[model samples]
Target: MPLALYLLALAVFAMGTSEFMLAGLLPDLAADLGVTVGAAGTLTSAFAVGMAVGAPLMAALARAWPRRATLLGFTLTFAAAHAVGAVTASFPVLFATRIVAALANAGFLAVALTAAAALVPADRKGRALAVLLSGTTLATVAGVPGGSVLGTLLGWRAAFWAVAVLCLPAALGILTGVPADRGRRETSGGPALRVEFAQLTGVPLLRAMLLGALVNAATFAGFTFLAPVVTGPAGLGEWWVPVALVLFGAGSFAGVTVAGRLADRRPGSVLAVGGPLLLLGWPALALLAERPAVLLALVFVQGALSFALGATLITRVLYEAAAAPTLAGAYATAALNTGAATGPLIAAAALTTAAGVLGPLWTSGLLVAAALLTALPARAATTPGRNPEAAR
Candidate 1:
């Protein structure tokens, strides 16, 4: 692995922190902005909406630019978005800033994944992606909870300020670390965006996209409301919210580590087994939410399963569309964000009924189970000699 990979991960750390920190700061943000909590919640969806649209749009716009320049530009834009967000007292301005930050975040992630895979051997792409994604898992573990504490003490704006400042070091790393020549090289003469997207409609690629969305949908449905889950149902104190989040983050980090090592050799099996395992944790948590120990245990397990298949899914899609790794990477980001945006709505709908906040857990579990079953038919397309990208 190269030092540049870590630089990519560092950028992702800043992006991931901003992306998820809002979940922990919801109450403070709502009160400070003088809006309903529901309106505050929309900020998360707003960010996701930006990512969903921005991934492909950025990929297309920067398709001709050097990877290093694109990455540096995106990181700077992200830092500026946070700076503006930190100063703005108005809710609308803050919301718009989130969209801007997410657009840059999406572009950075899509380019980083493509750049990462290009730097490594085909066989090691999965592990490379794991290294990149570990930044996000680490963010969930440290950044989100730390932001919550910071919000409690200094105000939520402080967290944004921190994220903004972190980008300076990350930008420097990208400037000095990644080789100029390496960044400029993508698969030369690859198909155009339209052609690449058309090719992406193959069965295996579609399945990978659907699976990514469903997995995130299942994961976020409960995660978006984790603080309440811990304090209300698990009977934990306010302080314990960070502890539980740490536990979940720890599980997610471990899951990514293990899955990275296995993805290249057994991606299909990873998805098949891990998806259902993920589903089980949800029902267990839903049934045992009132039991502190059980709820804690289930949260760890659920978080592990939630992220375990990530590298595998990305690897599968890249394999299916190898010639257009950047476009495929953009699509993967969009798919996950699409799910992130939709999952809360599903959770909200479930909460309106007798199911309550815990309803999301059960609803998410069913969605994961169905998603896994839906992916079964795509197995044949993943076999070694039948690669869609190769055939094309």
Candidate 2:
């Protein structure tokens, strides 16, 4: 990986911090905003919805724009949204800021996926993406805990302000480090919107994207409710919540590091082994929730397995959409965020029922079981002259 890739990852770290920090802050934010916890959780859903909808739309509009400019534009916009969010007293204003930040987040992620792929050899795209996504894992480890502490001590707004400040250096780094020609749009056949959409909507790519989406949904369904689960049924003190998050993050980092090496070469084999293991881990987690030590251990296990499957399917989406080039980023972003968006809503509904804290685990398990079905291999649809008829 080049220095530019690391720069992009740094930028992603800033964005990832803002994105992941919400899970840890939800309880405090709900109290501060004077709303029900479930209502406060909608902020996350709105962010995901914005990403799900905005990624392709923004990418389509900016497809012909310069990549460096596009990235900087989104970065600045994202920072400003956080800045706005930090000062807002009204929950509706804060809610609107999340949508804005998410739109900017979606555009940056969509473009960044292509930018990362363009920076590496075809064979290394999997590793490249892992390097990029490690930012999210790192956020889980450092950012979430730090934000939790901040929310616990300094109030939730401070974490939002910190996120806003984090973006400035990322924008500067992107401006100075990422090479102009290497990062942006080109005036080629790919710049045509019709061709890009046609490539994106193809069944093979769509199937691959669907698998990625489902696994991510499963991951977030459990993750979005982590603090509550840890405090309530796990019998852990409030202070131990960040400790639980760190354990999950550490496991995730390990999983993705291992995944980077295998994703391109043995996706099916790894998915076969890791997918079933991850599915079982979820229900086991719910069953063992009352045992703090056991619950914490399973949290780590689930995090590792969930991200391994997550990273692998993400790489698979990129592979299936190889023909789309630019819009591959949008397709992948849309898939992951769409899943992220759906999981929280499902978990929220489960919370409204008698399921309570453990409900998210069952919700996660169901999605994981569904995701496993879509993990089977088929002929690559993005491959020209290949039989599109190969069963997905």
Candidate 3:
């Protein structure tokens, strides 16, 4: 509830915009860089890979640094990555910038979640995280679509520069607003690898992570290819692409809002009921891609359900891993980014098939359906209804 929490969320907004804006920029980037669209889609995966690795690695390395300093460094690095990306003429150079940006994004997010939880009461962790994640949802509404519009008009480079410039104010806000004394007690040695491994391998925590990652994998798989879907198969104009993104983003904002209210109380029921609905959406979107109306309608539905389930699963991991406060952020980052990375990569491969852009939707459908096995035990949560009260 503190202003610092809002500052953290503001920083998250900039990060979220950069993280997701690529969905819109892909076609332009591919044409400009003289690569196949599938190759361009790899940029999303590249960023995800960086996040998956950088989250825990940076968390451990920066454990001894002041929280404010750590955040500032990551923010600056992220901003610089974008600046470099905007100017790069080579495809591989642009690809490398995405990795660096993702690493900075991952480290900041890994620390941000822990810092957010630390700022709020145990009972309020769910809502606090919701506020933090709202940045991403909101980015979908404004930033992602805006990037698409800019790419359509000014060029993809403009969007990248915008993201870089946005970070300047966010960095300033974090540097000043997050109090000097508001800190994680520094340790000479990082969190033990054994404890970190135990936390990851533990059944409940693992389940939470798996469920979260599966939902995200499915979500991003479809999301990464949304531009092509709207413009190509759906036979809409470039203008309609951002319109579709707006609908998805608006729905996502609503979903995360509801999840924040219920996740802490009913993590099981949330995932139980939401998972199937989320799964059903992908195939429906794919099968009906020719219908503009169906494509528009399902995009919103999928975004809402996918993110509600994702936010819940992610927040739940943070709660389940409460014993290891220092490692919690890293695990949270890894869980979320693992799905983000896997979904797009698989979907990108599908692009080369006869299905073309529609391949990502089928890819997402298959991934989530398979991911269902990972959440087999999450089905049991439907009966329990609420997480254990003591965990509060």
Best by lDDT: 3
Name every residue pair that clashes in candidate 1.
none
Q: Candidate 1 at 53: error in angstroms?
A: 1.3
Clashing pairs in 2: 67-184
Which pairs clash in the backbone of model 3? none
Q: Using TM-score as the measure, name the better of candidate 2 and candidate 3.
A: 3
Which candidate, 1 or 3, would have the higher lDDT against the true structure? Answer: 3
Q: Write the per-residue lDDT of candidate 3 for residues 90-193, one digit (tens) a residue.
A: 99999999999999999899889999988888878889899999999989999999988999899999999999999999999998999778775456454565
Model 3 has an lDDT value of 0.86
Score residue 58 of candidate 2 by CA lDDT.
89
* Models ranked on TM-score: 3, 2, 1
State every prediction's TM-score relative to the real structure: 0.94, 0.95, 0.95
Q: State each model's C-alpha RMSD to the native.
A: 2.1, 3.1, 2.0
> What does candidate 1's lDDT look like per residue over 1-392, in tens digits?
88999999998988888887776787788889899655777788889889989998898788878889999999999999999999998999998998999899989888888888877877787788899998998988898788888887899999999999989999999999988887773446667677877866677777777788888878777887777677788888867777777878888888888889877777767776887688788888989999999888888888888888655776676676675655867888887888888776777677767877688788788878877787776666434433333523
Score residue 185 of candidate 2 by CA lDDT: 72
**Candidate 2 whole-model C-alpha lDDT, 0 to 1:** 0.85
- After TM-score superposition, the amount by which residue 374's alpha carbon in candidate 2 deviates from its true location, in angstroms, is 3.1
Clashes of each: 0, 1, 0
